[model samples]
Target: MINVFFDKVEFFANNKELIKLIISNKRDKKSDLKKVIIKLIELKTELKLSFAYNHNTKDITKNFGINEGIILIQNLLKTDFFNADLFSTNETVQLISNKNNKVKIKTTEPTFKAIPKLNHDRIKKQRIFTQNNIYLQELGIISQNGKIKKDKHDKFRQINKYLETIESLLQESYWFTSGKPVTNLRIVDMGSGKGYLTFALYDFLTNSLNLDVEIIGVEFRQELVDKCNVIAKKSGFKNLKFEQGTIEKSEFKRIDILIALHACDTATDDAIYKGITHNSELIIVAPCCQKQIRKQLNLTNEMAAILKFGILKERQAELLTDGIRALILEAYGYKTKVFEFISTEHTPKNVMVTGTKISQKKNNSEILEKINSIKSFYGIEYHYLEKLLNNLSV
Candidate 1:
């Protein structure tokens, strides 16, 4: 991959400066363009660049294959045009290369390819989804804020809150816990810290409500998993168990739903990909540290430094990380939403991404447009989720 050069020119913003670097840095536009494009894709994949981007061009020159350049007549200095409100921005760039692979415009609605659509008849046959959300009273309490209200035992009530949230999300549609058609509901909790919520989720899924569930709490430390497993068994939860595994290579199989809370840095990305590859139906992830982007912010040019302050950099990282995840999910044909998870006794890193797979093939063009735009905004590529999505699940 080739590296990008910065220009001392006074016409563009710092973010656009990077784009200018790609366009003007090299002497021979055609030869160096390929290297530059490889570099861009690498940056997108490795560094997770281009998260804040809100627009993409079909211009041949920007295509990086010695192709044509797209010409846009919009106001380049305006921020509002690329700030997501204009999802239908009319940016044009013509593809120049003719004797090559003619890239076809992707259909917005993705047809079910590998994963066969579930037999909706089975669900209709049995009204398992007609039941109400499981209210685990013995689990714990919740405060005015979404924070879990703990008892004298320090049982994190946040787990109950999370489960309740999940239940509510599921209740809006048809669902089930233990049947042949719905035989694949697995929840893997990345960074199951103290397992307080783990136990609570288990009790709620199994004891309070008679549902067959397969719950796996993933923790790096063997001691914690062992202790949690012991506690779960003692609590009479046969299906809920803890295991020792890292985010990179966990034994996640047929995961219908994933719940990740505060898996630091790239680990959150790891958990999201894990769930995605396993064909999980719903993904709920809350990230912890934004240090990775914080470092990148420090590398920002003087222009960005002047506009966005120190704290703003961190906030940008947080938004970009979660925003990129949302795009990747959308790119994969999932309906994605982002919001605050909960403000608990825990730290204040409370951004959550919820993604549910589309029931049918829907337009993916809009999702792709959103993704490309966000990527341009942040100058990032290949987020953790995108990395996995680009590769096989081995």
Candidate 2:
């Protein structure tokens, strides 16, 4: 029998015991090792997994001489996994476990040289957003000493994912036009709760990307508005401010970017309406509640079987509502995309809808017709977004 052992097995709480038993027993059985390699990859938000002692590892070790590679382990959603040549003398390994826990492991070569130290610790590359950032520190994502707070890790990752989305949007050519640099930009964020993203965006636009921009965050809660305003003033974010107001009543002369994250139900429609009316270069929203469409949905008898379940029906309504919203944006000459902004494990409502206004634009009658057809098929009599557009046109 091969005795296998894993490094840091006692420390990792998640899937740690299973991993320890597999590796610790094989450590002493050097001749029986058969060049085994273990590789762990990130699959989903909640599932942390490890692979070892299988034929897959045996075959790979036999062929490649190097047996293990661990790519992005923690926060797998945002990072990429790579095959690490653990046996190579020149290889460098980085490990990230919990924010407070870090250790360097020394190992002997060849048989177990390529085997990664099995721990809950995840290896991360250069981060898109750093804990040392002042805004992150002020936001409580990190401690005063510039270490990520244990409780705030998820919030930190969520903020990074949001920034990644914004960065991607900036990279796309649809927002840049007339072969000119976009020096002047104005952004409006509707329902900016606690203003996490609002402040981060300001920091990124001004400090990182170095763009001249003004960002306004609208929140109905006066307390949150005041708090965020104070932070902005303290941070010397001259172009960033939070205002107390509803999305519908807030006035805007011009908007380059419009963001409405987790605005409940019809409020998302209002945000979209404001974006379309102002001809915002980019519109990004993450809608929540979706109660309006759920109330109005009347599935056909044939379709009722699956949708008859209350939970399923609610989900269907949510999808239909956003799907229609995207179609409407397309009708208005905006190229739109809908995707998961973050994993459902962090927040259940994670889908993001993004639209970028484009030139060479023509009214897409086909999308409008499809919208109407979908509405009729689902027995939906009214969609708030469509009604708002129709009322405006009238």
* Best-matching candidate per lDDT: 2
Give a tens-digit lDDT track for model 1, residues 1-394. Answer: 0001011111122222112112112223343222112111122222211212222332232222111111111111121121111111112122111123232221122211111112212222232221222212222233434344455223343443565666555643235321124444577888886676666666655544445678888899998888777766665667887888897788754787787888899888888887767667788888878666555433344547553777777777787777778877776667888876566454376677888876445345677677766665556554656666666522
Error of 1 at 245 (Å): 1.3
After superposition, candidate 1 runs with Cα above 4 Å error: 1-157, 176-184, 297-308, 344-347, 360-365, 392-394
Worst 10 residues of 2 by lDDT: 1-10
Q: Model 1 shows how many backbone clashes? A: 39
TM-scores vs. true structure, each candidate: 0.56, 0.67
Best by TM-score: 2
Per-residue alpha-carbon lDDT of candidate 2 for residues 1-394, written as tens digits (9 for 90 to 100):
0011122321221332222212221212333433233433334443233444334235322111112221212112112221112222222222222222332343343322222223223322222356556667777877888788999888877877887788778666443323245576899999998888888788866776566889999999999999899889888989899999999999989988999999999999999999998888899999999999999888776787888899999999999999999998888878899999999988898999999888436466788789888899889998999999986541
